[model samples]
Structures are given as structure tokens and as C-alpha cells.
Target chain A: MKQLTFDVAVIGGGPAGLAAALAAKEQGATRVLIIERNLELGGILQQCIHHGFGLHRFKQELTGPEYAQRFIDMVCRTDIEVMLETMVLEITNQKQIYAINQTQGMMQIDAKAIILAMGCRERTRGALRIPGTRPAGVFTAGAAQRFVNIDGYIPGKRAVILGSGDIGLIMARRFTLEGAEVKAVVEILPYAAGLTRNVVQCLDDYGIPLILQSTITCIHGKERIEGVTIAQVDQDWNPIAGTERDISCDTLLLSVGLIPENELSSQVGIQLDPVTNGPAVDSNLMTSIPGIFACGNVLHVHDLVDFVSQEAETAGCAAAAWASEKQYSSTRIIASTGKPGPCCPTSDSIPFDGVANECCATWGSTQIIIKPGNNIRYVVPQRICPDKKTTLYLRVRKPDQDVSINVGELKRMKHTFIRPSEMIKINLTPELLARHQSDYLDIHVVKEMVHHD
Target chain B: MIKTVICTVCPLSCEVELTISATNEIEKIMHNRCPRGKSYATTEHIAPRRTLTTTVHIEGAIHSMLPVRTYEPIPKELLHQVMQETANINVTSPIKMGDIIVRDILGTGVNLIATRSM
Candidate 1:
């Protein structure tokens, strides 16, 4: 086995890895390496051909590949090393990596810092457990996207989307443009799980029905997809008895949700937030293992790629700083040594029953724990440094009009409306956080009194 | 007549309401968080436009499909027709990003260009 050394090793050569590597290089970290599993560097962005990315970062609309190309071009201009078609098998707390590729049979990489940017995977049919015979046409919205956009093969003619997420909404339009009929986009929630722009442009533009509060109860097929049985559900998501209706379609695409690809994260025993299903890191994006950092979808699934780039860059800069100063000593990858950080960061604000794996490790003794309160689903960067200026990404549990979000006496901003689909950002300046005296910060959405003006 | 236009300029999705006079002119605009929504409502009322984004078949490329989009938003009604025209178009690889795929597509005066190099 050939052994190589790099200052920083970024896993997964997607938008996250590309941006992170670029930032690390810009931050004076030489010999940065990116390991990609695919033949190309642009991760899912290659298959995401439609525009709407880079709105925040570039202030202009850009296609996924275009957004990715800008970062790729920047990395190309630098001396950053790239290892394509390489699959990282394991990562150790000692900052060593074991990866394999066709060209390199087995290689070991010694790095001062590691960045996880593997991104997220789409939720599939097996996860849904929809009662049905094994069908050939059933596919995840992302899988269908790759097939059509990259492989140049349309999955089916008439399709029914199970989730009204951005992927499903985007694919609904894509299928329509490709001369396929998108019969309906069924979502269990009363509102769309995706952005309002996607719902308007993708479905409303094409006159595709977005059936809210409805879900596919059963999928019927023997060889290929024949049709699906959809039903309206109650508040608890239980299907109503007489609301079942059959929609005959050749394809049933599931855009249920996304899960952070944390298989390798767990392999290295990185602490994960139960709500985000990603790494539990501090304000600096540093995971439990000192030198290991996470960003982009690997940290939390972002609604936009622009946010992903912003986050990955932060992780990159932090990784570069870590590589410069190797100050960490011990490895507490074992959960028994975990600090049991703040129980669950979700709505249930109670501590765990002394379960080690259930809680994440606290970054420091003085790190303020951010807890979700009221209607807030979860807040990323579960821990924060009081003196640092930090931005906390959060999501609401439901949609509401005219609400003020309070961040532990740090700040309060009024919003015209808030929804689960749109992520809310709370900026905590050091001056504002100086007013916060508590060791833990509770973020909650509070209803303001109606103004008579 | 009143029209509620959802501003797609940003993720805020401000619901802008526009009041149109009988002379087919906008009399008042309300509820927009920014000036972009005002222009969006005016343009949407007279002639709604949309940027068409889709894939076209490409030969001699690493990937068989090439993503293309309009340089600027064309009339919203021309989207389906433009897509139909785009389906018949194919290009060879080694094309640069921003290269014109179709000039004056459907005579809508909007050029379809490649968004990424192949």
C-alpha cells in the first residue's frame, strides 16, 4: 500500500468538498487533497441541471453545474490535489485515511485535518414501506434526476410524485419538459415541503395538481408500475377510510426526504444531532474529534446549494486552522466518554436516561448549548462560543404568520411569515451574546400581539 | 381586477398584490417586501415571462445530455413551444459555457445557451 501525506483531506468531491478545499488553500493550507467516489468532481450538482442555485453567493441565478464549475475552476488554479474515483473506506481519529481506487489499489493518507463533505442521500421507497408488489418503475426523485439529466434516459411517461419536495417539484417540471405527464405531486403535509418558487414554477406553471394533506396509501404493480392508490389523511397522517383514489401511472417517484450520509461519520464515532441526523459541531464546525470538521449537507441538509457553499467554506477555513495547529491530544471516539450534551436538541428538552450514544459530546465546558423551543424544529451548531459571532441555521415546525423568534436574550427578529420549507438564520454578534448570561440558549418562536395600526 | 403575485426574486416569497385599472394599467401595488416585486407584478400582469431550463441531447460529450437555459426570461406561454423546439436540437461536445445553442428560439428573441461546458 502506498502512503501519502496531505495537510488536509476532504472526503467527497462535491460542492462541499470543492468549496472547502478552495477555502483551505486560500487560508494558506498547502497540499490539500479531495477524494471523490465518482468519476467527476461535481457531486449531485452534475445531475441538477436546472437553475436557481448561487442566488445568495453569486447574487445571480446559476445552474448546478455552473455553480460547481466556478469552485472547480478555483481549485484547478491552485495546487490542491484531487483523487477521483477514490472510495474512502475508513477514517481514524488519529487523522489517517484508508481509501481505494482502480488506479491505486489501496492507499493510506496521513492528514493533519479531515473534512467530511459527503452530502446527503434521498429517502427511498424501502424506507417508506409503502405496501406494494416489487415494481420496476418506482424510483427516488434524485435517482430519476440522474437518469434523465446525466444518463439521458427518461424513467417513465406518466408519473406521480410522492413528496412535494424540491427534488420532486424539479423533476415534475423536468419530466413535463421531456414530454411526460406529471399527474400529481402528493404531500402528506398541508403545505409544500419545498420552496415556494419551486411549487409555483414547477407545478403551478405546468398546471400539475399539488395535493396537500394526501399521501399514497398503496402502490399496485407486478412487473412494472401500473398505478397508485392515494388517500387524504387526517391531522395525524392517518388515511381516511373513503378518501382513497387510484391514479394510473407508469412511474411513481418518491421525494420523501433526505438523510445525511453519515455512514463514515459514524465509523469515526462522530457525534450526531438526533434532529439534524448529521454531525453535532460547535460554532467553528469542529466535530467531536478535534481535527475532524463537517459542513454542507453532511452537517445539515440545506434547502439551497448557496448555503452549502457558505457552510463548506467555513469548515474549510476551520480545517486549515486545525492543520496549522495540531493541539488536540486524546481521542474520545468512545461514546462512554461523551459528555451527554444537552440530551436531545429537539422539542423534548429533557435529558436522556444516561444513554451514551443518545447525546452528543460538548465542545467545551463553557460552550453554550442551543435548544429548540416553541415551534422551532432544530438549530444547527448545537454548541456555540459566547465570544464569537455565529450564525445559527434553524427550521420551524409549522407555518405561521407574524411571529418573533427569540434567541436566549441574544436577539429577536420579526418575520412576516415562517414556514418549515424555508430555513431561518439567526445571527448572534459578540456584543449581543455578551448580554446573554445563561450557559444554555433557548430559541423559540413567540407570537406577537396584533397591531392596531 | 386584483392579482396576487408571489415574488420569486428571493426565498422570502413575498405575496405582492396588484390592483389593475379598467384601462389595463396597474393602479396600486401592495405587500411587496422590495422593489423587485413591483416590477415583477407589472411584468406578470402585462406579459408573464419565465426562464426556460432543460436538457438537450449532446453528442461527443462525457455525458449524453447537456443542460441549457434561456439567456433571459422569454414569454411564459412560449415555454412549452420552446421546449418542443429544444427537443429537436442536438449539439456536439467541446462547447463552452454561454455558447448559444439556439439563436432567437421560436422567434421569441431569446437565445438558448449552454449553462455548463461539456
Candidate 2:
């Protein structure tokens, strides 16, 4: 086995990893390495050939490959090391990394700081628990996307897509353009799980019917997919018996949801937030394990890749600071204690076990706990250091118009509308955070009512 | 007559309702949050356009295929013809990003450019 050492090691080499590695290098981290399992530096972005990316970061519409190429070009100009076609086997809390590649055989990397950017995986049909025999044509929307976009192979002639995610919506249009018949896109939620732009451009423009509050209850066929049984669900999501109908199609695409990839984080004992299913991070995006930080989808599922890069840059700069032995007072305060703290009181209480609390002992520089209150789904960076400004990304439980996102009487931002499908970002400045008297900052959403005259 | 069109310019996806005159000119636009949404709804109500993104066959490259997209949004009705024209194209390696694979695609003045370098 060969041994190597670096100041920072980034896993995945996707959008998040690319941004993190570049930021770390720019932040004076002399030795930075990015380990990617794919043959190229771009991860899932390679297969995502559609445009509408980089709108926020670049202020222009770009395809996934185009967005990733910009970062890849920047990385190539720097001295950051990249290992393509390398699979990371294990990662320890001590910042030790184990990985393997065809040429290097077994390799071990000792790093001063590690960044988790493994990204997220698409939820499969098996996880949905749809009753049916094993079939060959059933595929996740992402797999089909890779097949058609990258591999140039159409999955089938006819298709019925479940879960109106962005991928599923895009695939519906792609299949139509490829001359494949897309019957309908069935979504379990009342509203689409994808961005409104996708639902309009991909589905509405193509004249594809989007059936809401419906789900595929059964997958029919033995060897190959023959058809599926789609039924409308009530408020409880239980299928209405008489509403069951069979749609004849050779292919069934599942785009249910995405779960953050965190096996490596869990292996190293990084505490995860039950709501986000990612590591519990502080304001600097550092995980509970001191030098280890996480960002992007591995930190939480982000609606846009632009935000992922922004968050990763935070993690990268923090990791670089740690590797360079920078004595930031805020870091010292947060890193002093590793024990879990108390959960903030909320009306809709989340289980105490689900919250990973880290209390700090340092004075003058106060540590604040961010709790998701009523109607707020989850907020990233559950802990915060009030010494600096920080952005909190969150989602609401349902759709509402004229809502106010309040952060513990310190700050409030108004929005025309809020939805679970779209993440809401609120920036808390140092002055606003310093004004709060309580150690626990409760973030909640309140729907404003308008009276008709 | 009134027609509702969802603006795809951004994630806001404002559902704009267009009130048209008897001659099909847009009389009023409602529910649009921004000027882009208003213009997007106007164009969509009149003539829909979409940017085409797909892969073309490539040889002597690191990968068997190269992802490409139109330089600008073309008429939505012409997407099928554009895809058909792209399907017959085969390019060689050393292609650079933004390099034109097919110029003036389908006479719409929109060129299909390579989205990535191979």
C-alpha cells in the first residue's frame, strides 16, 4: 500500500468537491487532493445535459456539463491534485482516508482536514415498497437520464414516470423528444416535487399530463415491465381502492426523491441530523468531528447546484483554516466542547435524539443553537457562532402564500410564497445575531392572512 | 380570451395569465412577479421556444458521445426536427466547449454547440 499526506482531502469531485478543493487551495492550503470515483472530474453533472444551471452563480443559463467545466478548468490551473477512477473505501474520524484505484492498488491518505462532498443518491423503486415482481424495464429517473443523455440509449418505447421530481420531469420531455411515448407523470404530493420551472418547461410545454396526489401502487410484469397500477391517494396517502387504474407501458421511471450519501460519514461516527439525513454542521459547515466538514448534497439536499458550490466554499475555507493552524476565536470556542446540547423549545417538537447538539464553553463569543420551529422542515448549520454573519437554508412543510420567516425575534424575511420543493435562504448579519438574548434561535414560518374588504 | 402560461425563465415559475384581444394581441398580463416573467409569458403565449440539449455521436474521444446544446432557444415546434438533424451528426475528438457542431441548425439561426470538451 502506498501512503500519501495532504492538508485537505475532498471526496466525490462533483460540484461540491470541485468548489471545496478550489476554495481550499485558494485559501492557502498547500496540499489539496480530490478523489473521484468516476473516470472524469465531473460527477452526476456529466449525465445532466440540460440547461438552466448556473443561473445564480454565473447569471446565465448553462448546462450541467458547462457549469462543471468552468470549475474543472479552474482546478486544472491550480496545483490541486485529482485522482480519477478512485473509490474511497473508508474514512476515519482522525482524518485518515482509505481508497483504491486500478493503478494504485491500495492507498492510504493522511490529511489534516477532510471535506465530505460525496453528494446524494436517487431513491430507488425498492425503497418505495411498491408491490410487484422483479422487472427489467423499471429504472430510476437518474439512471434513465444517464442512459439517454450520456450513453445515447433509450430505455424503452413507452414510459410512465413516478414522482414528479426535476429529473423525472426532464426525462418526460427527453423521452418525448426521442420519439418515445411518455404516458403521464404521477406525483404523490399535491404539488410537484421539482422546481416550478421544470414542471412548466418539461411537462406543460410538452403537453404531458401531470397527475397529482397519485402514486403507483403496483408494478406489473415478471421479466419485463408490462404495465403499472396507479391510484389516487387521500390525505393519508393510502390508495383509494376504486381509483386504481392500469397504465400500459414498457418502462416505469421512479423519481421519488434523493437521499444524501453519508455512509463514509457514518462510518467515522459523524453525528447526522435525522431531518436532513446529513451530518450536523456548525455555522462554518464543520461537522462534529473537529477537522471534518461536509457540504453540498451530502450536507443536505439542495434544490440548485449553485447553492451547493456556495456552501462548499464555506466548508473549504474552514477546512483550509484548520489545516493552516489559524487561530480564529470562533473556531476555538465551537471546537472546545464536543458534547451534545439541549434542543430548543418548539410548538411542533422534534425528537430530542434527532437533534445533534454541540455546546461550547468559550465566553464573549457566544454559541447559538438553531431550532426548526413550526412549519419549517429543517435548517442546515443547526449551530451558529454569532460573531459573524451566517446564512440559514431551510424548507417549509407545505405551500403557503405571504409567509414570514422569523429567526428568534432577531430577523425576519418576507416571501410571496414558500414551498417544500424550493429551499429558502435567510442571511443573519452579525448585528442581528448579536441582538438576540437567548442562546437558542428558533426559526419558524408564519403564514400572513389578508382580509378582503 | 384568457390563456395561462407558466414562465420557465426561473424557478419562481410564475403562472401568468394573458388576456388576449380578438386579433390575438396580448391585452394584459397578470400574476407575473418580474419583467422577465411578463415577457416570457408573452413570447410563450405567441410562439413557444426551448433550448435543445442532447448528445451527438463522437469518435476518437475520451467518451463515445459529446453533450451539445443550441446557442439560443429555438421554436419549440422545431425541436423534433432539430433532434433528428442532430441524430445524423458524427463528430471527431478534440472538440472544444462552445464549438459549433451544427451552424444555423434547421435554419433557425441557432447553432448547436458542444457543451463540453472532449
Candidate 3:
């Protein structure tokens, strides 16, 4: 086994890793190594050349590549060593990383601290369990992005995006820009899962119709996707009879969800959050294991790349602090409920009107929010760090005609419609707390009181 | 005449209602999100400049050289002129992403550079 050494090792060269490496170096970490399993750095940003990133950090509306270039340029100025086309096989609790590259077949590196910024992976068709014939035309949104943006190959002429996630909405426009006709964006949930701006710019501006409360029940194709059978779904998610419609299309793109890439985190023996399927960390972004930090999508699926950069900066500074013997003791861990939304509303109702009772379970600081079984999609605050300022994120299961989120006595943020796919963020501040600290908090979603401004 | 301009600094493109208040003195700024916007609005009222980035072809290389922007910003009206002039130029492959294609091209002491890798 080959041995190497660095003051800090950053895994996964995405925006988070790049920002982490840069921040660590700026914060006094002498030797930093960024290991990435790609021919170049920038991770998913390479495929996302669209404008939306860098608003918070650079104070400019920059494209993904442009935003990444800013950080990449910063890395070049520092003494940080970036290892491209490198893969990290495993990481140990002792801060030892096992990796491989063309130059070094297999090697071991021991560092004082390691930053896990491996990012997240897109949830695919297999995860969705969409009933379909195995065809050559189905592709993940990321794969299609790579094809069109980098490889210069359009996935298909006529496309149908099967999820209202940000990627799906962006791709709907991307395909159209490349001269492809995007028929419609079909989302099972009634509310849009993407950002409101994306819904306006990518869909509404481009005139792409968004079908809600619907799903592709069956895919029709032989060697390739010829068409699909879409149907309106009932409250139980079952397809409503006589509501099926057949649309002709050659390709299907899934932008259903994203899951944090935590395989290395698990190998390192870090305490994993059952809800997020990522590691649990404190304010400094240090994971359960000291000297090991996780940031960006690896910590949790972030809605925006700007957040990824911000979170990575925290992780990088924390890692540098750990190396310099800046110790943080007696930390009260705040658990993040994987289910995110704008409001945390609670009601003392059993077999609630539109909520799921079976999925309720307490994990750390998170509580299973109860709602009407049929209406609410997912609730956040899986656990809340009572004393600290935390944000509870949630969304409706599908788009509703009108909705209002109620969290105890506090007034909820009114929304015309809410979708489960679009994760909602609610700032939980000290003023909102009725007491210094509480054992648990209850949350729920209810019909919006009809009101107009 | 005093002109009202919007600041495009961030997503919150604040519509800045600027009152020139004649030659040196100015007041009446509104709807600005951050300090950056307010500063930009004041600066634009006096002297307007923009940062520009475009590609320059590389000799004997399949990919083009990315010439990038330098300094604060250049005049917005000169954008088309700069792009047209830079479109006809080429550079070498040893160039980095932000490498300067021309030094003080418009006598503004600002350099042109590459934006993305080819």
C-alpha cells in the first residue's frame, strides 16, 4: 500500500469540495488535497451551464460553469492540490482515505482531517418503480444534461419529462433550446416540485404545459420508447379509471429526487441520520465523528448550488479549525428531518383526514408530523434542536387548491398551492419558541383559508 | 436629466430610482436590496463600466482560448463592439481560463479573458 499525507483531504470535487478546499487553504490549512473522480473539476456544474448560480456568493447572476470557474480560479491561486480522475474507495474513522487513480493504482493517505463533499446522486426510475417496458430511450435528467451540454448530443427530438424537480424543469427548456419539442412536464403531485422561478422561466416562459395530479401509468415501446399512458391519480396514488391519456414521445427523463452519496460516510463509521440518510453534524458542520466533516449534498440534498457553496465553506473552516486544535465540546446535535417544507403544523387528530399515521417515528430531535392522511405529502422537523435556531421545511403531498400551514399558535405562510416535490424551508427562530426548550414539537398542514390580497 | 436605472447585481434586481440632484450631489435611492446595489447605482450615475469575457481561438489547438474580464466593469454600450472585435482574434493552448487576451484593449486598463474551457 502506498502512503501519502496532507493536512486536509477533500473527497468529491463538486462545488462543495472546491469551496471546501479553497476555504481550508484560506483559513490556514497548509496542505489540502481535493480528490475528484472526473476528468475535470466542477462536478454537476459542468453539465449545468444555465444561469442561476452565484447570486449569493459572487453578487452576480452567473451560470453554473461560470460560478464554478470563480471557485476553480481561487483554488489555482492557493497551494491546494486537486487530483482529477481519482476515486476514493473508502474512508476510515482514523482519517485515512483509500483511493485509486491511473497514476496510482491503489493508495492510502492519512490526514489530520477529511471533508466528505461527495454530493448527491439522482434517484432513478428503479427507485420510482414506474411500470414500464425496458427501453433504450429512458434516461435520467443528469445523463441527458451531460449528453446535450457536454457531449453535444441531444437525447431526443420529442421529450417528456416525468418529474417536476428543478432538473426536469431546466431540461424541458434545454431540450427546446436545442430544437427539440418538449411536449409536457408530467408531475404526479398537484403542486410543482421545482422552484417558483424555474416554473416561470423554464416552463411558463417556454410555454411548456405542466400536468399535475397525474402520472405515467404505463410506457409503450418495443426497442425504444414510442409513447406513454398517463392517468390522473386519486388521493391514494392509484390511477383513476377512464382518466388515462396516451401521448406519443420517444424519450422519458426522470428528475424525481436526489439522495446524498454517503457510502464513504457509512464506511468511515460516522453516525448517519436515518431521515436524511447522511451524517449528523453540529453548527460547525462537523459530523458525529470529530476531525471528520461533511458538507453540501452529502450532508443533505440542497435545493440550490449557492447553498452548497455556503455549506462547504462552513465545513472547510471547521476542518481547518480541527487541524489547529480548535476544539468544540458539548455540542447539542440538531437532527434534520429529511422531509422538508415551509411550515411545521401539528394537530391532535388520529387517522387524520389527509395524513399518514403509519410513517410516524421519532428519530433524535425530529418528530413525525401528523396531518390529514390524504392531503399532506411529507412533514419536516423530523427532529428539532429545541434551544437552537432551526428551520422546519415541509411541502404538501400534491398541489392543493388553497393551503395554509399552521405551527401551533404562529400564523402560517399562506400559499396559493403547495407541492410535495418542491421542498419548503421555514425559519425556526428563538422568538417562535413559546418556551426555552421543549421535548417535542407537533406540525401539520391544513386547507388554505380562502383570502385574497 | 436624471435617469432612473435598475441594479442587476443579484437575483433581487433592485429598481433604483436615482435622482442626480445635478452634477455632484445625488439622493433619492429606493427599492435597493443590498449595499452593493446602492453603490452600483451611485457609480453608474457618475461613470458606467462593465466586466466582459469572451473566447479567442487558439492556434494549432482543437479548443479555443477563453479570454476573460479584468477590473471593475466597462461601458454597457461597448459590449457589442468588444464581442465583435474579440471574435476575430486567436491565442495559444497554454492559456488558462482567465488568461488576458488583450491588455487595455479599449484603453480602459481592463483586460478581456476566457469564460469557459473549450
Compute each candidate's TM-score over C-alphas. Answer: 0.94, 0.95, 0.70
lDDT of 2 by residue, A1-453 (tens): 899999999998999999999999999999999999999988888889999999889998999999999999999999999999999999987789999999999999999889999999999977889998788999999999999987879999999999998899999988998899999999989999999989888888789999999999888888899999999999999999999999999999999999999999999988888899998877778887778899999999998999999999999987898788553455565556543334332213343232333323321244677888999989988878787668888999899888788988977788888889999888888888778877688999887776746
| DockQ value of candidate 1 | 0.74
Which of the numbered candidates is closest to the native, going by highest lDDT?
2
Clashing pairs in 1: none
Error of 1 at B57 (Å): 1.7
User: Which of candidates 1 and 2 is the stronger one according to TM-score?
Assistant: 2
Backbone clashes (count) for model 2: 1
**Which runs in model 2 stand beyond 4 Å of their true positions?**
A328-365, A451-453
Name every residue pair that clashes in candidate 2: A341-A357
Cα RMSD of predicted structure 2: 2.8
User: Candidate 1 residues A1-453, lDDT tens each?
Assistant: 999999899999999999999999999897899999999898999889888889889988888988988888888999999999999999998889999999889999999999999999999898988987888999999999999998889999999999999999999999998899999999999999999989988998899999999999899989999999999999999999999999999999999999999999898888788889998877778776767899989888989888888888888987887687433232233234654444333323332112122323423324567788999999988777666778899999999988999997768889889999898888888788878776679999999887867
**CAPRI docking class of candidate 3:** incorrect
- Candidate topping DockQ: 2
Give the 10-residue window scoring lowest on summed lDDT in candidate 1 chain A.
A351-360
What is the DockQ score, from 0 to 1, of model 3?
A: 0.10
